[model samples]
Target: MAHFPMNHPARPIYRVLSGLIGLYILMFGVWGVVLTAGESLFARESNWALGLRTNLAFSIASVIFGAFLIIGASRRTNLGHYMNLTAGIVFLVTSILMMSLLQTEANFLNFSMSTVIVSMIFGLVLLGTGLYDKVGPPELAEAERRSRDKQISEANTP
Candidate 1:
């Protein structure tokens, strides 16, 4: 089983990173909405917004997701942990799906190669952030840490 560090010392950094990503997404969405105001919801035509191809549908989705991420990052409880994990998976899956649909008529979000790359990067970061940002009681964290250390030592001995 995968062991996720709890009460990690670098939790603050991960939180900030997630927040920044959220801010960028929010800004990109707002700009996309402005640029694609009259365009079709799923327009296939190129409409660049904040360096990413977008449409009304994609812009709106970005706005909602960005807000969600911001809220998750602001929380001090495990809610943020779960949110980051979910967002990470969602991003990874979406990027793969969009990439596959990139050359097809089914590309509804008008995603570009750059967008896919960014999404993948964001997904990985979020996943890492989630893995280390778990919160718990002090004793539980200590116990988990000890277990992890023991596991590492055992592996090294083999």
Candidate 2:
């Protein structure tokens, strides 16, 4: 990862934004899992044991998914960005699947909302930065090409 000083061009804002988004994803994930596992409104059933098991499974899954997103976001490589995008898609898919099969649609909705909001913010950042890293900045590319063209022109002039 390129280290940028506080005064390094536009680096400060971008890094801070990325870090905040990372924190959001991690925090939301941790909270959602905890809510599911706790003796809360949604983790209710005639059979307390069953309810505990169901909520515990959900809690574990949510935490795992959230952790994956956080790790992916922390990586600065193009592969890392793609991994984060995949994690976002996983959140979307899990939300839809849970809603379709589970009776607790409301909790699922909350899960969907938080995952999507955090995932999108982080995913958008990943995509924007990945593109910038891959194709080089437009002005820089143009200048490099011009320099190369000038060299070629001089080489053939003789």
Model 1 alpha-carbon drift over 4 Å, by segment? 154-158
Q: Please, what's the RMSD in Å of model 1?
A: 1.4
lDDT of 2 by residue, 1-158 (tens): 44211122443344445455555544544554555555553453321221222344454554565555456546544444455445545545654564454445455333333334444555566444333332235576567667768978999997
**Native-structure RMSD, model 2:** 9.7
lDDT, residue 59, candidate 1: 96
Model number with the top TM-score: 1
Best by lDDT: 1
